[model samples]
Target: MRLLKQLGTVAGVALAGNLAVGAAGGGWVASLVLGIATGLLALLAYRWVVRRTERRRPVEVELAGARAGLGAGLLVGTAMFVGVIGAIALLGGYRVEGWGSLTGAAGLLGVAVASGVTEELLFRGVLFRVIEERAGTWVSLGFTAALFGAMHLVNPHASLWGAIAIAVEAGVMLAAAYAATRSLWLPIGLHIGWNFAQSGIFGTEVSGADTAMGLLHGVTSGPVALSGGAFGPEASVVAVLAGAAAAAVFLRLAHQRGRIVARRSRALATATV
Candidate 1:
């Protein structure tokens, strides 16, 4: 009932946004603008649905703790991406070729920003939150993380291993961030920073998509495990290990905050009462 309506609202709004933006067919700039607008609209829709179905206050969807989440997310995201890439470079697996086009890097930032806001709104804000209410933390986390990774199968040069890497690295990590803070802003900032640094700053392929020229043009050469092969640095072993470590940290924070929901038995007991 309520769950279905909320899900429908999210899906419907997302579909509408995609159609509207895709049909407009402006170059990267127009697409970025439309994508961001759609993300805002989706957030509004989520707030509306949640208010109606769950009786949450307006502040929950507004600026409540947004600043902290944004700051934490940005710092963590930048450090994680830089750390992974830096490790590869230090190992002599990656080398800088030359400078890249500033304009190209800017263009990629727009894309990353659009992707960050929109995906966070859809995945963490709407889907994960809604599902968490019904399914509890671990179930919601696993389901949404798997779906997030599975959705990437349609990317330009996607592979099974790439998807798996994304599932463990990004999907779980971002969800855990949300679990830790119970806010979308952190995950949104984290997503934006990670992607921007990966493609825009480091000038690498992002999730198998060709990137605009980056700030630092470089070539990666090493074993597939270390170099990330054709799927870019995101598929590298360093990324996986770093992401797992980050998830553990956030999970600990979530546990400390009493934010991690217990299993269904406990949840059902509360519902029964």
Candidate 2:
């Protein structure tokens, strides 16, 4: 019941926000305003719901050190995407056609912020955290990551390989980030940074979704495996490898911090003893 309530509340806000953003039309100002509003509302809803359901302060979304966490995550996430683009460019998979629209980039920024916040709140803050309490970190991570990837399959250009790539790269990477930091801010920032860089900066499609052209008139061409084709670079093998490497690093940090939870059965047995 608690889980349902938490998920329902946050998910409701996210859905409503997306609807509102869509209703606002394609104007950059409207999208940016609505997106930011929705993101803020979702955060508030999460905090409120957690308080009511768990009867405790929601420290994961706590504002303390939020800026630092978000800033660090944004830097790392942006750098990672840039690195992937760089690699693809070296292989002649991507190129700059010209400068793109700043307005489009701004619109994408709004979308990125809203998505980054709401998704991290839903997956990392609610699903992963709740499941980890009983199933253990490993189980929770795998479950959430798979679900995350599966969700993307509904996208316009989605494919089996694309879904798998999303699961392996973004799903696992974001969850591991939460595991390492025990907060949603880092993952949220990373999510925003990655999305914005893809659509807002590099002017590329994101997760098969057609977005406004970003700061640069970037173009991709070559094999589907390398260029990611219509589904974008996120579907590239490079993205998978980079994301997996990052996940590994975060997992290692989590282990060193003793943040990994034991299986419920093992925990119960230890308690009994």
Candidate 3:
């Protein structure tokens, strides 16, 4: 019940924010403003709901470490995508055609910000964190990662392989990031950086969703396995490999920090003895 309340509250705000963004129309300025507003509201909602339900400070969103975490995450996320694109280009998969629309990129920035903040709050802040407290880190990571991929199946260009790629690359990697830092800011920044770099900077379709032209007129060719086809490079083999490598690093950090949670049964048994 407590979990449901927290989830419902945060999800509701996020949904409302999406709708608001849509209603904001085609203007990049409006979209950007609303997007930032929505993100702030979502954060406040999460904080408020967690306080009311758990009666404790939501350390995952504590402001003290927010700037540092977000900065590090953004840097890592942006560099990762750039590296992936570079690798694909080396294989003759991606190329730059010309300049793209600044307006389109600005609008995408709004979408990226809104989605990044809300998704992290909903997935890592609520679902993964709550579940990890009971089921253990591994179980929570697996379940949430699969569910996250499944959710993206509704996208226009979604494919079984794409969903699997998302599950492995984004879902697991993002969760591991959260686990390592125990903060939402890092994953939130990562999500924004990746999405914006995909569509806003690189002008690639995000999660198979059709988007307006971004900052660079970028194009991809070659096989689907290499270029990610219509679903974009997020589904490419290189992306999965890169994400897996990053996930391994974050998981190692989490383990070293003693943040990995034992299953509830094992914890109970240990306590009993």
Candidate 2 per-residue C-alpha lDDT over 5-59 given as tens digits, one digit per residue, 9 for 90 to 100: 9989989998998888778776899888888888999999999999998899999
**Model 1 clash pairs?**
none
lDDT of every model, 2 decimals: 0.81, 0.92, 0.92
Give the Å error, residue 40, model 3.
Answer: 0.7
**Each prediction's TM-score against the native?**
0.87, 0.97, 0.96
Q: Report the Cα RMSD per candidate.
A: 2.7, 2.1, 2.2
Model 1 segments beyond 4 Å from truth?
Answer: 1-28, 58-60, 266-273
Tens-digit lDDT track of model 1 for 120-199: 77778777776787678899889998999898889887888889888888899999998988878899889988998988
For model 3, residues 123-153, the per-residue Cα lDDT tens digits are 9999999888888999999999999999999
What is the C-alpha RMSD, rounded to one decimal, of candidate 1? 2.7
> Clash pairs of candidate 2?
none
How far in Å is the alpha carbon of 270 misplaced in model 1? 11
Q: Could you tell which candidate, 1 or 3, scores higher by TM-score?
A: 3
Q: Give the candidates in order of TM-score, highest first.
A: 2, 3, 1
Candidate 3: residue 106 lDDT (0-100): 94
